[model samples]
Target: MCDSVAIIGAGNIGRAIAEGLVAAGSYAPAEVHVTRRRVDRLADLAERGFRVSADNPGVVAACDTVLVAVQPQALDAVLTGIAPRVEAGRHLLVSVVSGASIAAIRRHVGPDVPIVRAMPNTAVALRESMTCLAAEAAHAGALDRVAELFRAVGATLVIDEEHMVPATALCACGVAFFPRAVRAACQGGIEIGFHPEEALRMAAQTALGAAALVRDRGRHPEREIDSVTTPRGCTIAGLNEMEHRGLFLRFHQGDHDLRREGGVAVRR
Candidate 1:
């Protein structure tokens, strides 16, 4: 178990990770330290018993594990600030900052520190994120430890660093994509006369059930569709309509576009 953790730049992703750790009972709130430029924004975390401050280097010096969740643009400054304080062989650095390569981080922190890149969605708040991890061969042990920590909150996969960008588009960005589909379903339900609240609940639950079928049963989506679709059935008709409307094509296009743009597709 990780004895202590410090989340640098405790913004949305940072806060979500901290919440996931505490919610999973992986770490007590007091064992986690959260830092941001504005300490006032972290008052709630302090109230929850987490150590909160604006002193990044101080927190880095105190924690065993450090999660760097700052914006890509802010990464260099944060890394530079904390680099001197990071003790070799003592701190495990897990970065969630998008677009920053492991080599770039190493350049800032030096060669001896173990660095792992993690891509986890906001679903982490619900302990249901699909997190992807990547690290160099030299840091394999640190990667395993970080993977275990993330597994407390959700499923995890280890992949080549070269594939991390694509994984970000598919898993992290896919979080937003799936929710938008659910919202579209809710809209369709509203048009069919269901109350908005009821429609949203039903649509969300149905989506969950569909996903669970694929995950729990290990069935291909098309195979599951075949079981529910029948000749002259409404299911088949709706499926055809969605296909005709380019729903799947749009999703594929979005993935391609994200990849082409270097995986910086989502602003927030």
Candidate 2:
């Protein structure tokens, strides 16, 4: 039911949100507007029929919803620049910058404008993200719309804004880190005498299939794991080896230590 959406940055997260919003048919690509200094990187969006601009103010002034997607350090400056151009009840600000809070945005952008704090990981680009949503104190429905908007691209959950930083610490950053863990698992498969390409495919597909088991089976993952884990069978033997190496437990529970060695960002 949105007339237009403007994204204040053309970074990966911004692109994902814009693409999802437009692709979901809530609005057309022509109704989507994007701005960034790097004009070249916007070619894909431009080709998809979005209005690409280098002027954030021009874009922000024209849209019903505006997404602030700059880096955390740049958020204040971007807010300051766009504050005056945005009038009360005309634009609702949706922020995706990590670690920044809505109270801070209200202090910088004035009190009347509705504000939403949106946190989504890089998986958004693939339409498989898990996004967290929050709104300025007492500004209801703002958060719901934001959550629904993100649902077009991926799954979403609503939680207190105070939880966002830790949620970000756990998931947003972990999402990037999770892939490296997957790659490491694939490498381990290769070291165990499986051909590299075959091992990678098998590892990736196994992970995918395992996840689907939870979705398709409508039960906990361990239940599915237990289903195939017969007493002392080849699967159990392999399971025993994996358990001995801690790989089985670590890989599934999103283990912290195994993740740290793989370059997981635990904060910020």
Candidate 3:
């Protein structure tokens, strides 16, 4: 494992990755070098013993693994600025910026530097993110290394680069969708007589339990859903009502729109 990392653009996702890595004992606070244009925004990290700076090139030169977390609009400038310092054999570039492909990044940093693209969602802060990773076949070793890094935070899946946009929709955007579902459940609970706080606790835990059943048991979600839904029971009734309201169609449409938008964002 690399002993140090430079997280460029230490925004929300970047900060989450930094905190998760340190909290997991994978890296010490001092080992993580974080950078932002406004260094004052990183005062908390500086106080926590992280090497904080606004100097992109300097930070990249100091770390072996460069994790780019900048927004798409800022990516070009950040990569171009650090291009001079990136050495092919000495550094690995792992990017969490949505839509920017390895080829696009390679253009800025040069062909020899291995680039891995990853998408980790909102749940990353809780160390429960489902991160999707991709790299060319020639960079498989780098891909494995990145996978190991992400596993310290949550699960990881390596897919073909072509599927990265859809992965963003399903895993990254899916975190937000699941919470909306939980919110709906909480609303239903309130209607059924539970107080707001009690309803939220029950709904969120139920959602977690449902996900765990599918994950730990390695069963299909439909199979798990079937287990709780007896023929004439309320469970089936609620499910049938949701289906009647086009739940499946709505969810599929939501994913499709997000994937489409992600592709558009990358092109821009």
Candidate 4:
């Protein structure tokens, strides 16, 4: 278990991590401290027995593991606030702020502090996130610990820091992308005479099943597609129509655009 955890900027993503940790039995509510600019914003967490405060430095001083989940634009101020209180070799800093590099964070917090970057989608609320992590060679142990913590929430991958941005585009932004596809499918269902709620449920469950087939069976998605698309079938007709309309191409282009935009794909 974590000795103690502090989540700076107890916004949406930060709240998700905290809730997941507690729900997964990885940590007790009292063992986590969450800070927000306005302590009133953290009332729900406080009611759940988590320590809630507006003082970032105080929270950092009390915890061994700190998750920096602030907005990228607010990171500098947060780092500066907690820098003096951060004890080198004692505090493990993990940042989930997109577009902020380790080098920039180190410059603010000091070079001796171990830093890891993690990118997790909003799915973290359900403990079903796909989180990608990266850290410097010197911080490998810290990286592993960070990975272990996130694994309680969902799948985690350790990759080169250079790939962190791309991972953000693929996993973080891809969360929104996948749901949009589900919505489109729901719309199509509605057009075919299903009620909106029924269509949504059917589309969501189908998407879930498709994902589980690839995840659990470890087969290529094409294999599953092949199984469904028999000769001259309606499935193939729809698939061909979508392909011809460039549906998959649009997703690829969106990923490219996200990367080009420096992985600031979705606002926290």
TM-score of each: 0.98, 0.85, 0.95, 0.96
lDDT of 1 by residue, 1-268 (tens): 7588999989998999999999999999999999999999999999999999999999998898999999999999999999999988799999998888999999988899999999999899889999999999998999999999999999999999999989999998999899999999999999999999999999999999999999999989999999999999999999999999999999999999999899889442
For each candidate in turn, give its C-alpha RMSD to the true structure in angstroms.
Answer: 1.3, 3.7, 2.2, 1.7
Question: Highest TM-score among the candidates is held by which one?
Answer: 1
Off by over 4 Å in 1: 266-268
Clashes of each: 0, 0, 0, 0
Q: Over the full model, what C-alpha lDDT does candidate 3 score relative to the true structure?
A: 0.90
Least lDDT summed over 10 consecutive residues: which range in candidate 1?
Answer: 259-268
Instruction: Write down the worst ten-residue block by lDDT for model 3.
Output: 259-268
**1-268: candidate 3 lDDT, tens digit per residue:** 5479999989988999998888877899999999998999999999999899999999998999999999989999999899999999899999998889999999998888889999997677678889999998999999999999999889999899989989888887787678989999999999999999999999999999989999999989999988888878999998889999998888898877777776442212
Candidate 2, 1-268: lDDT as tens digits: 5578888987988887777777677679899899888988899889989999989888888888888998877888888888888887777889888777788988887888899988888777667788988886577777877887888878898889877776675667667656776798799899989998988898888877887789777998789989998886988887777779886565445545434434234343
In candidate 4, what are the lDDT values of residues 1-268, reduced to their tens digit? 8598999988888999999999888999999999998999888889989999999999888999999999989999889989999988798999999989999999988888999999998888798999999999999999999899989999999998899889988898788899999999999999999999999999999999999999999999999999998898999999999999999999898888888888776432
Q: What would you estimate as the lDDT of candidate 1?
A: 0.93
**Which of the two candidates, 3 or 4, achieves a greater TM-score against the reference?**
4
Better-scoring candidate (lDDT), 1 or 2: 1
User: Residue 126 in model 4: shift from native, Å?
Assistant: 1.1
TM-score of 2: 0.85
Ranking by TM-score: 1, 4, 3, 2
Better of 2 and 4 by TM-score: 4
